[model samples]
Target: MKKDPSIMKENMKWTLAMDEVFIQALLDQHYKGFRMDGTFTQTAYNNIINELKEKLGIEFTKSHLKNRLKTLKEHFKESYDFFRNGKLSGFSWNPFTKTWCAEPEVWEQLLQEKPEAIRWKTKVINH
Candidate 1:
């Protein structure tokens, strides 16, 4: 059976982090800066985890942080000309802003390039 392009495109939409609020907070905090270094830091990672435990009552792992950031970056690529390389911090680190700016654009041309059915779907928290 042939796959429906719309369904395939919709599925292409990356799964949302289990803790989206926390993920968004992390992105807003760590992924938005004009520096010459990677956005994520060891200190920041620890602090964020501590904050999550205290406020959200969740014990997150280092792998969780990495996965959430990757998913967030995937969303940015849907609307922007984003690039990344290397592992860990190097994955989403944009050398230009020295942070995690996606260089997002709202141009109709670019948006038109994407399928209309594309959207995000949150996954249940397994952690």
Candidate 2:
């Protein structure tokens, strides 16, 4: 069966600026007590959605924000593990460049074990 075009929604491509705005809005809500027990309240999500709409002129649903936040958290966890866990040797984070740095051989070995680490080598997350 063919899907109805009007009911079908295209995936939203979140730009870096949009991500930054969303994170800032989330942090603002968190500081205002919108986050409790390690999860944001529904009101917090609404507030973030409104903020994003006003600031970025983009309308985002709660699901969109939630999904993006989930992806961001996953990236954060991976970065934290690789840089702070100390289990992997020869990996150092460069604050100035906002990227992970290591010798060529070190990266080769790390890729063998965790190929996902390559994405963060140059991709900088403001948070």
Candidate 3:
């Protein structure tokens, strides 16, 4: 649905200024990924800001936009060891699968062999 101009203005007033909008975008990109089909991509930071300008009628450049997103990632990592290990899927510890089962298997496979990670995680989880 198209936002009414007056309502859009009110939303803008309540929203944080550009650059400061990092955390939400970072989390959104990490978790939400894409919303408008494939408008968002692996290199989506620039596209997202450009589209946001059209959607929100606010302007931001690619460089600063990326910087803001990077800072948000840094903040998230600094605050959590789970994120440092790239585990941000937010699952309760399952004794049967000590690892975050909420995460996709491919995500756990990034560093080591998939089967090994699964086996190790399974043991830790049960141990």
Number of colliding residue pairs in each model:
0, 0, 1
Q: Point out the higher-scoring one by TM-score: 2 or 3.
A: 2
Looking at model 1, report the run of 10 residues with the lowest lDDT sum: 117-126
Question: Each prediction's Cα lDDT score?
Answer: 0.48, 0.82, 0.48
The TM-score of candidate 3 is 0.33
Q: After superposition, how far is residue 87 of candidate 2 from its true place, in Å?
A: 6.6
**Model 2: residues >4 Å from true position, as ranges?**
1-10, 85-87
RMSD after CA superposition, every candidate: 14.8, 4.2, 13.9
Preferred candidate (TM-score higher): 1 or 3: 1
lDDT string for model 1 (74-100, tens) is 656632332223232222444444443
Q: Tell me the lDDT of candidate 2.
A: 0.82
What ordering of candidates by lDDT runs from best to worst?
Answer: 2, 3, 1
Q: Write the residue-wise lDDT of candidate 2 on 1-127 in tens digits.
A: 9865432354568888998899899999999999999999999999998899899987777878888888899888988887774456897666787777888999889888889878866787566
Name the regions of candidate 3 deviating beyond 4 angstroms: 1-43, 82-127
TM-score ranking, high to low: 2, 1, 3
Candidate 1 Cα misplacement greater than 4 A, ranges: 1-36, 81-127
